[model samples]
Target: EPEVTQTPSHQVTQMGQEVILRCVPISNHLYFYWYRQILGQKVEFLVSFYNNEISEKSEIFDDQFSVERPDGSNFTLKIRSTKLEDSAMYFCASRDTGRGNTIYFGEGSWLTVV
Candidate 1:
């Protein structure tokens, strides 16, 4: 089965640096989302995008974060200024359809900020 794939399963960065986490969503899906889990916390939705525009975004998606579909297959999340609280597992997810559809997660891109 096709699955979402994330790069640099483990990332280490300083407290005030930039980081780009990459993801390749399922080929035939139309919607893309980014979720984050801060250590032992519940999964939190950051943003969702479809058709080249943002569908929804949570408050957690503040000024320092951005998402882009650089091409047909790649979806990327860029953090302009990392913080200690930014240490978390960043997940890339996608759903083929809506209305009771479930999102699938990549193993996760673990970001560690010191």
Candidate 2:
């Protein structure tokens, strides 16, 4: 079975720096989503994309963030400016189909902003 993969496993950066978290979503999946879980908080949705455009996005996806399907196998999330509050585990997930398919998470890219 195919699975999502994220790079760097852990990242450390100072506030205001640019950071790009990378992921390779499951092949043949139609919907892709980005979510984050702060150290002690629940997982929160950031954005969801399909058909090459955003299908849904949460308030957490602000001006500092952007996402792209850079290639057939890679999806990326870029944070133009990082903040302390932005430190969290970012996850990439894909749905095999719209109904009944549960979105699964990658191990995650743990961002540490200080």
Candidate 3:
């Protein structure tokens, strides 16, 4: 099976700083997404993108967050002015174009804001 890949497996930054996480979705996948899991909490959806545009976004995705597919293969998530509460494991995900297709998640980029 194909897989999603993320960079900077772990990052530690000061509060109020900026961070950009990168991901490479499965080559054949058309739908991409960003999800985050706080310490021990359940995974929460952040945003989804397709066709070079945002398809949906959760309330958690505020002005501080942005997503982009800069090229054909790379997808990125940027967080501006990070906060302690923003510390979590951000997972990149992708799914093929089909009804109820399985969504595959990356190993995750762990962000630690101090």
Tell me, by lDDT, which candidate is best: 3
lDDT of 2 by residue, 1-114 (tens): 789899979999999999999988888888999999999999999999888888999999998999998788888999999999999999999888858998978989999999
- Rank candidates, lDDT, best first: 3, 1, 2
Candidate with maximal TM-score: 3
> lDDT for model 3, on a 0 to 1 scale?
0.97
Q: What's model 2's overall lDDT?
A: 0.92
C-alpha TM-scores of all predictions: 0.97, 0.96, 0.98
Question: Which candidate do you rate higher for lDDT, 1 or 3?
Answer: 3
What lDDT does model 1 reach? 0.95
Which ranges of candidate 1 are over 4 A from the true structure?
none
How many residue-pair clashes does candidate 1 contain?
0
**In model 2, what lDDT does residue 90 have?**
96
Instruction: Flag the better candidate by TM-score, 1 or 2.
Output: 1
Model 1: per-residue Cα lDDT over 23-111, one tens digit each: 99999889999999998899999999999989999999999999999999999999999999999999999988867887888989999
Q: Per-residue CA lDDT of candidate 3, range 1-114, in tens?
A: 678999989999999999999999999999999999999999999999999999999999999999999999999999999999999999999999989899999999999999
Give the root-mean-square deviation of each candidate in angstroms: 0.8, 0.9, 0.7
**Model 2: which ten-residue window has the lowest total lDDT?**
95-104
Error of 3 at 44 (Å): 0.5
